[model samples]
Target: MLDWLITNSWLVWLVLFLLLAIIEMMTLDLLFIMMSSGALVALFTALLGWPFWLQVVVFCVVALMMVLFVRPVALRHLRRGPREQATNVERLIGEQALALETVTDHSGMVKIGGDTWTARSSDGTAIPAGARVAVERIEGATAVVYPAAGPGPFPAQ
Candidate 1:
């Protein structure tokens, strides 16, 4: 059994490659993919009749080099993009809102993005209803707003 396994070492390397590839899919990180590339090198070495220990050494070297060199480049390219992609509460910043009720420095209500939210004035003042405001930031469940520069109320149809 041992003799037959020694002769069929390529099968072991191929299986290792497949397992690493499956783990890469699950992890979505580049680490496993780099290791799988090493496993592929090991598989080729096995096919070329290299000894098992030498194949493992080659695998280790290749995987280490890829992780130390290639992975950083790949990650940099993958993450490179526009720095601004407003999401969730971040999208509300600088957005216009309508004061639904008298908003004071401490407590009030405003309609932001068509949804009502507790609000406070950024400059600690009172804002009357139907006034246009700009969301400065969100504090807990409240939106901090400032008077928007421009027309106050929308024109009636």
Candidate 2:
């Protein structure tokens, strides 16, 4: 069986390529897609009557190029997603919390969603406890807030 497979390496390479592509569909992480491309390149080389060693070399070169160059560019785009300005979902945007403790000169604790978080006022004003505040931004784990005045952070809904 082994000897026969070595003789018909193109079939083996083709099956391997197809298996990789199929698995890639399930995984969706993009790593196997690169391997699948190399496998297909190997299959093509084998179909062209190239010896096993040359086919292996071509597969390795193609796989390396795909991994090093193509994958990074693809992943970078995938990681960032469409660059539509900062929204409320990101940290400290569109959040309402109460000042847990007195905020004096830009330092205090604010309670939001049943959790206490370090907070600061952008205008550097001292806020008392039990004050309704609006999250303006976040630095690290801390949330910057301003007193809720006039219309609240969220409009009537």
TM-score of every prediction relative to native: 0.53, 0.58
In terms of lDDT, model 2 sits at 0.82
Encode model 2's per-residue lDDT on 48-138: one tens digit a residue: 9898889989989998899899999999888775536545446346677788798765689988766778988867898898787888888
- Model 2: colliding residue pairs: none
Where's the lowest-lDDT run of ten residues in candidate 1? 148-157
Model 1: per-residue lDDT, tens digit, 33-118?
A: 99999999999999999998899999999999999999999999887645376567877888788888989999889887668899
Q: Which candidate has the highest lDDT of all?
A: 1
Which residue runs does candidate 1 get wrong by more than 4 Å?
A: 82-157
Judging by TM-score against the true structure, name the best candidate: 2
TM accuracy, model 1: 0.53
